[model samples]
Target: MERSQPNYRLIYHDIISIKCPGKKEECSPILNKKEISILDVIKLNMIIFGINDKETQIFNQKHRSYDESTILEILDYQAKNNLNNTQLANHFKLSRNTVAKWKKHFKNKHLHPVKAN
Candidate 1:
């Protein structure tokens, strides 16, 4: 015997109900589950929550961008603690690529100053 996949349509409706509460008009009806992918559900949730790519980018810029000193501190911590890029990323709330970039910049002595937005 094998377990069956959960019905995504029901899950979508449940998410919509949770997001909209008692507002039936605000919730969009799912006409065809076959037409909906995980990405579609994600987009729907983003719309319901008033989140867009621009807003996400702005949020990331505000939170994720680090100053030169902070970047150096991250590199120092990584070296002293013998941590990997993933660990540094998790500790600093940054991506692995960011940690790798900082390491590369530190080595190359080309660490760019974080621009004020």
Candidate 2:
């Protein structure tokens, strides 16, 4: 049986409050939210904290899933930036082997995109 896709929607409380000096302050529940893609989340992390080789190794220990669109975006970025497999892997904290496999897999799937398994 084929596996179902995972939910990538992430929600968090971004509460903003006002303070008063020695007076009963009034507060209201404000929901400030926006939908962000998982790829954007990963990009933000990389921007905020420059990932090192050790961190990349540790991150590689964890298994993460990416949809076809996301994979295509990554590969496109690699092409746009003129990055080799190793450089692209280091930038995204992915295994070089994984990058190579994705390149090979997608290249072969060009003619039969829907048949990628």
TM-score of each: 0.39, 0.54
For model 1, how does the per-residue alpha-carbon lDDT over 1-117 read when each residue is reduced to its tens digit? Answer: 976545766776776677665533444554254555433444455556765587785675455335565567567667677777888777655787877777767864533333211
Weakest 10 consecutive residues, lDDT, candidate 1?
Answer: 108-117
Q: Any runs in candidate 2 off by more than 4 Å, and if so which?
A: 1-10, 13-35, 44-61, 108-117
List model 2 lDDT by residue over 11-116, tens digit each: 2111111222222121111111244445754543344344668777586547667777777778877877778888888887788888888888787443323222
Per-model lDDT: 0.59, 0.55
Q: How far is each candidate from the true structure, as Cα RMSD in Å?
A: 14.7, 9.4
Scored by lDDT, the top model is: 1
How displaced is residue 27 in candidate 1, in Å?
44
Clashing pairs in 2: none
